[model samples]
Target: MRGPAAPPPQPGWALKAATAVVYAAILAWSVFSRGPEGLQAVAMLALGYAVILGLIVFAALAFFSLWRRFRTPRNRARVMLGLGVFLLAAVVPPFAEHNDDNRQRDIANAEIRKAIDTLRQQAAGGSGAPEDVPAIDPAPRASGPYGEMERVMKTVAGARLAQHRAYLQELQEIGLPRLFDARRLARDTGLIESRLILEQAERLVPGYRRQSLDVLNGMPALVRSLTIADAEKDKILAALQTSNAASNAKLTRLWDLESQILREFGQMITLLDDNRQYWYADKNELMFGRDGDLRRFRQHQESVSRMVGEQEQLGVQSLAAVPQAPLR
Candidate 1:
């Protein structure tokens, strides 16, 4: 019966139904997994696929029309020409859009690199706190075993020792002796001034003369006591000189240690500044898709922080070890 009625016109809609099912499944999954953003991404992908499919269909139609018009050579040539133009039109826009995006990205990257270079230059040229160590204050001049030892040390044979020796010797021989002489002179001047004041009071009032004589009688003993006090003062100064010598030695050692620590601290600061500059220069790489670079940068930062913390702690301990004077 007419070749089985052309096999019931084979169901061409079956393929389209299967495609629709696949698309629905993908959309459902996208919605379930990513919410609104997923839906947006899927919509964009679908739009792009639709455009591509439409282009393909148009191309296929043009090829089919060319075949159908092949009987007339002139018409065939014209159709082929039209198909080529249409194909170029369809392809060129997407390529141009892609090229434009690449150009924009390159321009942005170039600007970022230029900024990084400027930062690097600035960091390289920058200087911070002065690195020169401060001079230690001179030790006090006094008397006793410490002074004797210091006097001996001053004569030692090296240039370094010789300088310190000269300083201590000068303190002992000239500075302390001059200070003692000045103190004696001041005491005598004060005594003389007191006597003059009392004498003037006696001259102004006859009744006060008796009181002044009583005070004047006490003056010789006061002068004798002052002489005795001067002897005691010399003894005290001798003890102070010994104490001063020991204190000076300790202070010298502290100065040396502190200077070393300060130099190391300055170096650490410079290194940290350099590290900061490096981080700024590579910030885009660290922040964006460069996972490996980010990891390395973080590790370096932590290492440096830990090292500086340890050094600071050690410095604190060292400072604490130095003896401090008791508060009165």
Candidate 2:
């Protein structure tokens, strides 16, 4: 008679329950740690489930072994240790990567904020004094079209465009109420700067009034974009005072309008850039002998004008597409 009746066989239900608890715990931890932001959360859960499933399969195979390998406590302990190692390997990297990404984003946002403050100050006319203006050399003027003066003007225009683009991008990142404030600052500064540039152009090339005028005319369109954005924001806020459904619908329209406005703003900037190039090239032709450059320049101007006209038409269409309020 065997050693005192064999102890009752261990139930498979207990083993299954234990495995399920471990799986659930791992999944919960992954989700909570990642906070459901990106693919990393999904990946972590998938990997955890895969590892657990593999361990379940391995245990099943070992239990069915002809030699009964899993029957021994020592073999089971080794199997558990291997599973732990595999689980650790599968889980650690994603968390580390997510932490690094968050840290870098914080640093970048801080730098952007600092830059926006500096730009705001400069836009408010924080430059030192009128005496700070660097003196331009008064060398004898070259008769050729591509003279030193024209070169200098091109350089300055390019620099201004770059600075404006950076400022716009920064404003866009900050979003809303602040966006309007920054834009107002930019608009005021731009108008003043445009007038000054026009005056300088008149002095440099007396007959170049038309080109400068075209450049000046584009400035208002840019400013109008800012005004439209502000008006739309106000309208959205006003709409929120009504019923929830109407408010939500208005908000959707406002979002669509803001997107369209941004697109138009970008296009307007591109058009202005083209205008600047055309103006300088045209000025050069007037000074130097006419060449193929002038023909290409005119073609570019026409293309940009057509684009601007299309943008205007789209703007009108977008306004029309907005649903009218129901009569009370």
- Candidate 1 lDDT by residue in tens digits, 1-328: 4554432223245444544554444334333333235667868766665576457555755666656544343443344344445544665457555545444434434433333333233223222111211122222122233222222222111222233233334334432223213233234332343334333322333333233233323322322332224564355445444454453443344334333433443343333334442332232232323555456545655664555454444323322211122101
Residue 211 displacement in candidate 1 (angstroms): 75
Q: What stretches of model 2 exceed 4 Å from their correct place?
A: 8-25, 29-69, 72-78, 89-91, 94-162, 165-197, 201-328
TM-score of 1: 0.21
Local distance difference test, each candidate: 0.37, 0.40
RMSD for each model, in Å, please?
36.7, 23.2
After superposing candidate 1 on the true structure, give the runs of residues whose Cα lies further than 4 Å from its correct spot. 1-62, 65-68, 126-328
Output the lDDT of residue 120, model 2: 35
> Which candidate number has the best lDDT?
2
- Candidate 2 lDDT, tens digit per residue, 202-295? 2332222233233323332332333224564355334433333442343244334334444444443344344443332232132113455446
State the weakest 10-residue window (summed lDDT) of model 2. Answer: 319-328
Task: Looking at model 1, report the run of 10 residues with the lowest lDDT sum.
Answer: 319-328
